[model samples]
Target: MRIVIAGGHGQIALRLERLLAGRGDEVAGIIRKAEQGGDLREVGAEPVVLDLESASVEEVAERLRGADAAVFAAGAGPGSGVTRKDTVDKGAAVLFADAAVRAGVRRFVIVSSMGADPEHRGDEVFDVYLRAKGEADAYVRAQDALDWTILRPGALTDDPGTGLVRLEAHTGRGSVPRDDVAAVLAELVDTPATTGLTLELISGSTPVSVAVRSVAGN
Candidate 1:
């Protein structure tokens, strides 16, 4: 399978790239800076640099063409402000989804936060971030051309992955290792049955493959 991931330089995306490439799947990651290319190459993923915040739909679609799947893992870092939350979180997500449609790439996966809600109201940066993610998720869910699966993980931790998780429609709120999250994403990409499902992830007892297969009903 050929997979293209936006926000390719992200911690989770980097982990996912290694997993997919190690499995012999062709992998490409979209990055914002050329310097990040080498990092992607180190993980056996081809890096394509394009700023989602400014790239046009056609430009992005051109990059996505012929890919078996697309993953939206982009985000404005925690240091970013409210405006970027809208632009990167919501706007870029919508653009990427449209590009996937334009390119005829049907399988889409998105990384989202646990408390994300479009109706959420607050003036704080975190609140805005949630709303942005919620709005973007809403857009992806509405697209008919895409077989989209949204993964909303709880608090993300940098600790080592246990390869175990609680994968469900709602897993409440808990922290999961970035490694575990990437493992689940790799599983989700290959599990077509998971299409159209919005799942929650966090550390738990079930093994990664089993957790994913259970949700996918395989």
Candidate 2:
């Protein structure tokens, strides 16, 4: 399958690229930095320079041409102000979906935060982040023509992947490694049953690959 990943230089995006490329899938990543292009090429992925904040839907769709699916994995990153959080985290996600619709891309997978649900998220300094994620999640779900899946993960860690993961409709107080999260994203792309579903994930006793397969009763 051909896959397009936004924010391709990120740690999670790199992990996903490696897994998909290893499986012989055609992977293209949109990165902001020119240097990141070399890194993507080293991992067997074609890299395109696309800035989400400034790119138009038509432009993004053009960049995404020939891809079977698009994964929205971009973020504003820590230390970015609240406004940037909304622009990158929420606006960019929405823009990508719009581009997907315009381009007639049927499959989309999004990496979202676990506490995006207002009922589940408590008031805190990160509330802005949560709300932005929540809004983006809802936007994806509202598109009927698009086959979309949102994966909500808890606090992110940078530790080496344990591979094991837990998957459910809702994982309260969950935490997951970034690598594990990438693995799940790869699985979901190929798992038809994962489409149209919103899932929450975290570390578990079973490998992430196994956990992802189990979500669809495989």
What TM-score goes with each of the models?
0.99, 0.94
Best by TM-score: 1
Q: Write the per-residue lDDT of candidate 2 for residues 35-145, one digit (tens) a residue.
A: 889999998899999899999999999977788999999999888877877898899999999999888888999998887853336545478888888889999999997
Clashing pairs in 2: 163-208
For candidate 1, give the lDDT of residue 19: 100
lDDT against true structure, model 1: 0.97
| Model 1 segments more than 4 A misplaced | none
Looking at model 2, residue 9 earns an lDDT score of 90
lDDT of 1 by residue, 75-155 (tens): 998899999999999999999999999999999999998989999999999999999999999999999999999999999
Report lDDT (CA) for all predictions.
Answer: 0.97, 0.88
